[model samples]
Target: MKRRTKKLLLNWRIILLTVFLIGSVVTLAVRPLTFGIDISGGVALVAQTEHPVDADTMQLVVDSLQKRLNTLGLRDITVEAQGDQIVLVKVANVTTAEEADAIKNVIESQGVFYMEFDGVIFGTGQDVEYVGIYQIKPDNTWSVPFRISKSAAEKFAELAKGKTGWPVDMFLDPPVNSLLVVPDSVYNLMNSSEFNAQVPEAPTLLQRITKAFNITVVAYANQTADELADMAEGREKIVLVDLNQGLQSELENMNVTVRLVQRGPGESDHALIIRTLGLYGPYSVGEGLATGQPQQDVQITGTASDRLTAEQEARQIYTVLKSGSLPVKLNVVGMEFISPRLGENFKYQALLAGIGALIAVFAIVYFHYRNWKIAIPVASTSFFEAIIILGFAALIQWNLDLPSIAGIIAAIGTGVDQQIVITDELLGGTKETRITRRSNVLKRMGRAFFVIFASAATTIVAMSFLLIYFVGTLKGFAFTTILGVVIGILVTRPAYAEIAKYLLGED
Candidate 1:
């Protein structure tokens, strides 16, 4: 036993698992498992591009969506790219179907950016080549510079050759072929002075929205369901402020997309426009830029009350300019909402179920072995397998849903079966002696390892397909399952082999 303990300690396989176990414990302590909507309660959305995109473009899509929401003061969201064309978004603390619908609209509305000079389209998002770093002056003013393509710059110069000091308007993610339906109260608020005061030198809110954006703003009270539904005949989307079941049903029957926009107290007209229309600025054409010089460099300048505000302003514009120029568009492929109360109940049930499964595993393994040394090691290996799998998830911040938990259990069960193989191989049945020859024991361990590797490879291959082809909950399942199989093959199985060999009275 003393010699066997030394051999076990000196084993390279044992050392590998021990190191991983310690690292996994540290990882868990630092970053715990991030639970999915099914467990922690929120919204899960899958958005897919119209056509497949490269890895870089897919990442840009994710970043663009994240920044767009962050600009709207939504920070508790995760955007992840799946495959080459799909994106997964998880938003926390969302409970209502209305909020989910609003979010879905926002993600789907990434549109082309256009800069117009006197109502003529001079440049679009396609013209932008690069966005420079944001700069802050000694004062609390910030600027974000960008460069356009040579052709686009030349075209802009021709459009504004002598039109100095003109307001060259910038519009991003504009609502094309869309309508806004609002109640009398909200419509009156939009017509108020405070609302129009948000935009400098701009006309009335109603006039500017109608003229500049071509969006028909109709008071729902003024139009009957038949009239509204007829008006929406050629429209792509209808943004409704207050919920009206009759109009919604009519529009739905027409196969039109109707989205809800919540009206909050103290909502400014400019903010409402930004939310509904995505207009950015009315940048003044300087003498230099408007002199027909074909200039490529341009900057967006603004003043903020403090350094923090200035930084925020500059960063937001920088992020938008960098990411919003991507030409691809995403459509909502799937959506799921889990209420907080239901998620909590599911979480408790998962915990209880995991514990019960673990207990049963130990009992079955102990009954089969009838040896404390073998049984203890087998059960402990399964337990450690779970910890290490969770640790990997925590390290990368993977969201664990029901499917992920099931994958973990399946991996652990496979681990126990493999461990039993190693034990039986070492013992060589009842006909064999306790102290088998060293060379024979080595051969048996090699065979056991080969079997373990083969099993793990098959599992990993099947899971890799699922991980690449699927999005949302299934990705979580594939990821955790693959990680478990890999850890078992590389760390736990070989380590268990070493321990079992030592226990069989081999040096």
Candidate 2:
């Protein structure tokens, strides 16, 4: 080779060498290889709704679920829709069976309500203007005040006339005294005749007086504004209350039941309004149920099972039923669980098979090129592509299942083919002039790039659909395949082409 050609080759070699060194460092430092759930056993649940659910709706649910799972600090969690009606959830590093069950329970409890209070003021000696409790924190700490409507302020003053400085409990539900606010004056209220007359009947009278106090309040239970608006028309005003722990225990243990006296034509069939206080709330009404029916006793049919797993599952079922039903019903028509032992065995076999295929391809390229110089670059580029793909998989925490392995193998084959195309263009030199020759090589490579880009685009589209519409291992395959093809086209293939041009004295 001429000195100039040697210089060019040296320069190109240095560039390739630098890329190889940096790629090696990145590969070693990053060590991106993801472990799938199959190797690390985790929980998998398949839920199906009753109605047909579209992808958009399912995606929303999955996004909400992802947020909840993240809040719980769970790792390697995957939630996706399998079909139109079914959703699949997989979580890794689950410490206990109860954790899995709790996840299921949370998913079942789709309605989440959060509230915050603004401010509270004590009742004056004259009258209480408005009574309400404000939440001070996310944990439900509250401040309460004795409030009376402007119209009823006079009656409040009469009831509290001589009882100034007396402490009155602000009941959130029953037995839950949120706070106690006392009037400023006591002597003026104690000397009044109204104080003595109401002293004996104070408790009962106080209850009646408090009941008449009207306060403006805002409440939300995760129902959308549109849903609330639709339900608000012709809906009778109802008071909802949150119960304290003591009140919840009392209600749970009591034999109290609720019955409706009448049913309205517009009422839902599943509605069952209760007057009794329960664990989470007072005067709880079952959602999606009809209203205005004759009142009947309600027996808490739930029983604690001896087995914790069974009890937890039951609670999940109850939550799902209580929350509105799913838009689409799903049936787990098929499920397959591969044991860790099997996974290990398959992995070993897959490793051997991949090595064998790679060796065979490298040997064929060496014979076809008849030049060790060309074969080395081709083999190195192919190996580099595979390593980079795996490194990325590990870095991004992608699950590497059998299907993902297959994708990497396919990417390697495609990469080798691309390298061969570059080699052929460099060797042919069919153009009459030197510039024409160079232009021809570039045009050929450009066409090759277009074909590769188009192929990658199609694969991405297909994989995206699979990821969006399917679940489990298939999604793993699609994800890895897309990643591999994108990286091979954008990075490895271009680098290989540059190396080939310098080797063939085209530059």
Candidate 3:
């Protein structure tokens, strides 16, 4: 018995399982698995492309969006293509409206940049070489310098020859309104007097922007402009046209805008037209700055009330300018926010479900076998299999969403079934076939593994399809399931067979 125990302990299968078990525990202790939005409480948005795109193009868009989100330091984000035209984005740990909006902008930008004069395109965002902070006469206001291509510069010069001081509008994804969509950090930076001093031509730079939105204030004696040129953007222009002059000035002091108006809100149809920005109208530039033939250098300026605000605003704009644009235009069709507290509740529930599954599987297996020797090892292997799967996920930094939790449960079920097959093959033979030689036991175990291997292979194949073809939230489920099966077959199952053989040999 002592020799047998020593041999079993020294078995290669046992040694491998032991190593993985230890490593799994250590990994869990050191770097725990990262939770997804469903578990950590964040936001999930579904966007539909403005026009239909092929699957490959959709995939490219998704990949590009993922890259953009990562640059924002948001590591826990999933950008997947759903069908051919819908994109799904999940951002973990973002609870604020401001954060959600920032992500939305990154996902929806069509990236079709253009600079036009009097409705004629002369340049696009592509013409701009770089967008960065420009120290124009330091200690005064700062400006954002856009270095354009020589061709763009010459074209602008030619256009400006006769139309000097005429508005030369710069646009992103032309025909879309330009409202200077900036992040909160950047909006604060542009409010500074120092920054505004440098770009004196941009009168609308310091307008009160709340949560990266345009807020236009009108005097107490209410009336709307003949046509707020920049009103033709993504959605209807939401102007604060009812406020008094004093409040308007206060908001402007904080870098907000309050202007005088002479007409009422205008016709209802006009309101709808502004909502869609004519769907395909030339986008109006804010504060319509006049341009000289800027020889490859263009400065954009905005006012920030303080220094930190100016810096943050500049950083935000810099990121937008640096990142590549989206391929197709998209509109936010759905958005849902999950609070952290609710996510915490989900974590607890998942834990309880997993524990309950383990207990239930063990009870059933023990009752079926009526032997601790067989039941204990089988149950132990199942438990260790889960740890291995979780460890792998953590090591890879995979986000643990609700679907992933469900996958873990499915894998546990399959593992228990496989273990039962192994035990039955080893112990249920008749006297003529049972109490056999070590060679015979090896043959029986091989037969059991054959069945296990086939089942595992089929499962993996099915999951592969889901992972490849269905690439949205379902990906989490398929990924965890495959990981569980591979670990079970390669790592845990072999160890279980070895332990069963040792115990059965003794009997």
Candidate 4:
């Protein structure tokens, strides 16, 4: 009996089963699994394009958005094109309202990028060749160096010839209202000798103003108040600026007045940023345009309170420069922010549902077989198949959302059904057939697997449609279901057949 058991354990089917079970357990314990937005809290947004677009164009839009969102330091993000012109976005772990709003603004708004040298439009997003960060100074303050198209570079060289010592402002959706522009001089000043004392509180100033104020405030770099007039339309716009005599005079001349309110820290809930170009005193490029060489590789740098903030700012700048602008405008039609607590509840309920399903399957299988030797292996094999499926999910970092969990349950049901077929074929025969030769048992198992394989193939064909055409939760369900079916046919079912043959003394 010991020799027989040893041979059974050494069988290829048993060996494969043992290896997979061990690997699954190790992967579950070590790597852990990534959860989707439905399991982990996050924001789900469905934004519709202003008009219907061709399939290829919609795909391009989705791809662009995916690339842009990836630059935002978010690892778990899904951007998929759905329906005629709708794009579905899911970002995990975005719990705070402030973060969600900021992300939403970025997602909904088209990033119109422009590079201006001394107020001349020299390049757009199309001209951006590359963007990256490099540490120039010994202090480890990083700089973002970007290259523009050769044509734009030549144009910049020409336009910048006379204005060698002037500042350049890079804008996203230019003019002013959007409040997304970075002056070339701010980069220098932040890296200069007087940075520590003159920079003010970088944290307090650089943060995107989250406080609610009565009047709308807009910030610009090089653009004058007259140029920003359209941004102030239909709203009470209050312009705020650093205590600059020249900027104040420019605003007065442009008929856009500046109002300075005196308030201590935490005094009121209202705050606005005007971010003037000349805020950091006069600093020039110093006849660098005298070189007049094509300014293809230009470095833009800025200050942040910490390394994390600097990385974020760099990524945001890179995204704006790279993504440029969406081809068509998008308006958010549906937005749902799932709280982590609710997601936790859903996860718990899903677990309970799976447990209940397994228990019910066990009872039904045991009652049908009326023998522990037959029912135990069947139920155990089904349970083992589930573990293997989950292990594969974790190994591949597939997010387990509610739909995925449902898929696992559904797959286990299919597995149990197949296992029952194998058990019945081996056990429920005439006395002569039941006591048949090992070769007969092998033939019976082959017949049972033929039925199993055919069923598995049909199920796979059905789920393939859902996996391909669907984009959201349904796709996940189909994926898990198909994966489970494949594993059942290839791995678990074969191992179960071998084990059942050994247990029934068919060998």
Candidate 5:
């Protein structure tokens, strides 16, 4: 027995498993696996397009959203399209309700950018060729430099010829065929001198905006449903600024698409204009740009009160502009926030489920074999397989969610079943046959491996489809399941065969 034990420890198959076990531990320590929103608490948003799209268009949508989030330095995020219309956006480590809202806004931002001078469109997101990193200006404002296509540059130069000091309007995802509804107070502010400082030509800013954007305007003043309906007749929707809840609900009852925006305290006039009119800036055309030189480079500048805010604003702009525009707009259908406490509870529950699965498998195996030797090996191998799977996740930094935990359990159960097949093959035959087959351990294990390989292949194939075609949430489950199976086939199952051979004195 001592000789067999010594030989088993020295066996290369056993050593392979031992090396992986140690390596998995060390790798996990170096780079731990990141838990998903289900475990770490974050935001989950469901968005849908107005109409279903083709596979390529859906892929473009996913890529665009992914770029925006990643550019903002969000490391653990998933943006994937389900079917041809719905998209799931998930971000880990977002704990606050406010942060969730901010994420929704970012995801829904179509990133459509355009600039026009004197109501003549000159540039769009398609015109952008390259966007450089943002840098702080001497005036303590952030400026993002970008390059436009030569054709767009030339068009702008020709349009702005001999026309310096004129305002060039910049807009992002501006509404079309829409109406801007402001409260009486906000409408008065739009005409105020203080508001004029932020949005020059303020007294007539609304009319200029109405002309530039071709959007209708109306002010709320105890208007009846019919009056509101008349104003909304030719519009696709109504965008209200600082409007009361009563108006919003009434409009909803009228079957009108309405978007309500709350005006922030001391928000500048342009800010409100950007919200209601989609007009962010009225930047002045420079002499150099108006000289018809066909300048290809331009800068879009913004100022914030503090350095941190300036940096944040710069990154926000950079992220949007760099992502370009989505092929279709996504309307947020649902937003869910998972709290940290709930996340902790979920983690605890996942731990319990994994432990329960281990115990259940061990109990069933022990009853079937009536031997601790066989049952213990099965359980330990299953446990080791889990560690290897986790190590894979850590290496790739895959986010583990509840579905991923379920996949691990499923994989371990499959491991137990395959081990049983090997054990049954070894325990078969009469005394003479058993004696004769002692030297045939490799052949018996090989026979059992045939069945194991078939099953593993089948599971991996199914999960591969899920990984490629499914949404963000299901991808985690598919990935972990595939990882578990691969690890078992390559690492744990072979070692378990060696242990089984040793236990039966086949060595």
Candidate 6:
């Protein structure tokens, strides 16, 4: 082949590679993926434990939770221990109240293992038992397992008429504890005569079940079993109890007796007993238990969603309760749901902002290069980088929230900077000394790589911290930024360099 022809072939080869890279990005952009809060949201919970838990132990707990979240198929999830008693978790794409609640439940859940035989208690509470420490799903749901006593499992199953899995009613106890309930059908079959005699028309199955399985939850700060029993006098209450030394001390020192009161005639009344089992503090026990004394103490604030789904969410809460009390009890210091209007407006602003930034970059590159040959490649590379990022996001089903959008914009800038370097080096050289020019261009590219690498590393570090220390928007920005920088470095930069070199006949 002629020398010119040989050079042309080499150039075409480089062009082909760049095209392939760009094409792949295009394909990905058309179909992007995203992650959920469990996958990508930051969750920091400061639980007030009845006892002091060291940092190492807290880290262990967080690590366990992170594993659970990973099991759920979430990527980029981080779990860490903050201070002596706080566990911090950060994930991406947890944008809604429902998602946040779901993540919280998973982080807080204490899972237990149980085996049931027939409808009677057969073994001791600790036999062949495990608890769920954490569990996670790709869609951002996590469940943790812990050990439980075999006897407790049997008792719970007996109470639940041989139904065993996750005990819905045992959230107040350690995750390993069991709570059982007789189903409505069994109640109807067993109490038909009395039920019929009391009400000739008899209520529906649901009503009967509700009446038969009535339960109430209460929270007590510090009190012995005797004190709790005294408070429950004149009331038919199913008492869910937790004992910790710290809670006991707090109550005693404060001269406080906490009780939860529910007024209504029902099949069963529920009360929560918070006491110190040891010298530490009161560990939380009981699901759906009220906090404080009747008309006093800290109340379980916030209205719950209607039944069904709310109950399911409550089951998640129960899972956390089962896990055990947090290292420190955290009061809901701030609880504000993102309003729909605000979310919409924020999304709009983010989209517009990203578009504006991209257009500005494109204009600057086009005008600065002053040649369509150079500007085209830079612009194409920028566009290709975005497609790839978006495609990956869509393929992963990553939620394209506001912060993530910003990450995409930042990636665009990074891509542009790299492209500018490639264009400068390529255009400054000639075809007569192609090899020397190519060497110089590669050297320039290396310097750009160093800068890009450093920037990406710094961004990753910042994101990691935000992901661990903060929640909500800050976390979103961190996640998106990290992802964008990663994509820019790995996919976009090299492809643009190749394109620039090929265009300049320097390949």
Query: Which candidate gets the maximum TM-score versus the true structure?
Result: 4
TM-score computed on alpha carbons, candidate 6: 0.48
**Residue-wise lDDT of candidate 3 within 1-507, one digit each (tens)?**
998889889988899999999999999999878999888999999999888998656765775566455534355778877777788888988898977987888676655545655435577657768665544333434456767789987776665554433344343322122332322333344444322322334333234122113333222232223233334234333233223445434444544332221122232322322221211222223332234444776665555667777775554444344433444677999999999999999999999999999888878877876778877887788889999999888888889998998999899899989988887778755323564666766677789899999999999999999998787668999999999999999999999888887877722
TM-score of 2: 0.51
Candidate 5, which ten residues in sequence have the lowest lDDT sum?
194-203
Global lDDT of each candidate: 0.76, 0.50, 0.65, 0.68, 0.77, 0.47
Q: Mind giving the per-residue lDDT tens digits that candidate 2 earns over 370-485?
A: 77778888888877777777766766667787888888887788778767766776676333333237687788778778777887788789889977666678777777778778
Q: For candidate 5, what's the RMSD?
A: 13.4
TM-score of each: 0.58, 0.51, 0.61, 0.63, 0.62, 0.48
Q: What is the lDDT of residue 137 in candidate 5?
A: 65
Better of 1 and 3 by lDDT: 1
The numbered model that scores best in lDDT is 5
162 Cα displacement, candidate 2 (Å): 28
For candidate 5, the per-residue lDDT at 415 reads: 92
Ten-residue region with minimum lDDT total, candidate 2: 275-284
- Per residue, candidate 4 scores C-alpha lDDT tens digits across 22-128 of 99999999978889998899999889999998885687577557654543335588988888788999999888786677568767876656665433567777788
Greater lDDT among 1 and 6 belongs to: 1
Residue 342, model 6, lDDT: 56
CA lDDT of 5 in candidate 6? 49
Candidate 1 lDDT, 211-267, residue by residue in tens: 656667777765766677677677777777655556666766777787655443356
Q: Output the better candidate (4/5) by lDDT.
A: 5
| lDDT over C-alpha atoms for residue 334 of model 6 | 26
- On the 0 to 100 scale, the lDDT of residue 36 in model 2 is 64
| lDDT-based ranking | 5, 1, 4, 3, 2, 6
